[model samples]
Target: MAQVLKRFFDLIVSSGAILLLCLPLFLIALAVRLESSGPALYWSKRVGRRGRIFLMPKFRSMRTDTPVVATHLLEDPDRYLTRLGRQLRRSSLDELPQLYSVLVGDMSLVGPRPALFNQRDLIELRRENGVDQLRPGITGWAQINGRDELPIGEKVAFDVEYLRRRSFTFDLKILFLTAWRVITAHGVSH
Candidate 1:
């Protein structure tokens, strides 16, 4: 019942956000293109529900030559950052394009965030805990608790908890917390 409600809410809210934020999205895309000599959007292979692969889009925050890997795993990831990349990341502007993912059912408004396709350990742990059955989210329990800073094990633990405790209220709280965290740029490293 809650899953159905959550999906419905995700569709409605994501649609509204897309309609309202179209101008901002266009402006951000222009900014990204003007700052770097590459496409404004970066399409990444992300692990989705049940370990499926999906292309997730974000503003091109890193240089064109950046290796396809987790930002945390990069050798001096900051060295690959494009102009205004840090500000985009801190303000969460780079993630605005993912609204299309949520609208298309590739993601939810709240759940465990999708892992990079190469994040085998996290994928296996999530599969073991039945978290893979749920749709990934733009912001989630793990995200609000500790986004880039959480260890894989601890992040999976939070994801498992979310799997068990998920509800409309819980998702609403996560969304609220995500907004606050983004505003404060809390727990975002690199």
Candidate 2:
């Protein structure tokens, strides 16, 4: 029942957000293309529900030629981050494009964030804990709790907890907290 309502809300809200952000999205796309010699959007394989592979879209925040690795593990990630990338990432604007993922049913407005393709250990742990049953989200409990600063194990724990206690009200609370975190520029360890 709540899942149905949540999905409906996600559809409505994400659609409206996409409309409102269209201009900014266009400007960001232009900036990304101008700043680097690659596509404006970066698509990467992510682990989704039932161990499926899905292409997750984000605004290009790093050099197009860089090796694929966990964001935190990047060698001098700041070096590869483009000029606009810094602001987009810090302001959480880089994730606005992911609303399309929600509209397409590949993601949710609230859930555990999608894990990278190479995060084998985290994937295995999530599968063991049945966390893989939930769809990936744009912002979530783990995101608001510690974001990139949290270890994989802790992230899984928060994810599992969210799975167990998910509710529309809970999701709204998470969303609100995420906004606060972004506004205050906290937990943006990336």
Looking at model 2, residue 151 earns an lDDT score of 92
Candidate 1's residue-wise lDDT over 10-93, tens digit each? 999999999999999999889988988999999999999988899999999999999999999998999999768888998998
Best candidate (score: TM-score): 1
Off by over 4 Å in 2: none
Which stretch of 10 consecutive residues in model 2 shows the poorest summed lDDT?
A: 74-83
lDDT of 2 by residue, 65-182 (tens): 7789888898788888888889899998899889999999889999999999999999999999999999899999999999999999999999999999999889999999999999
**Candidate 2 clashing pairs?**
none
- In TM-score terms, candidate 1 sits at 0.98
Query: Model 1: which residue pairs collide?
Result: none
Q: Candidate 2, residue 13: CA error in Å?
A: 0.7
Model 1 CA deviation exceeding 4 Å by range: none
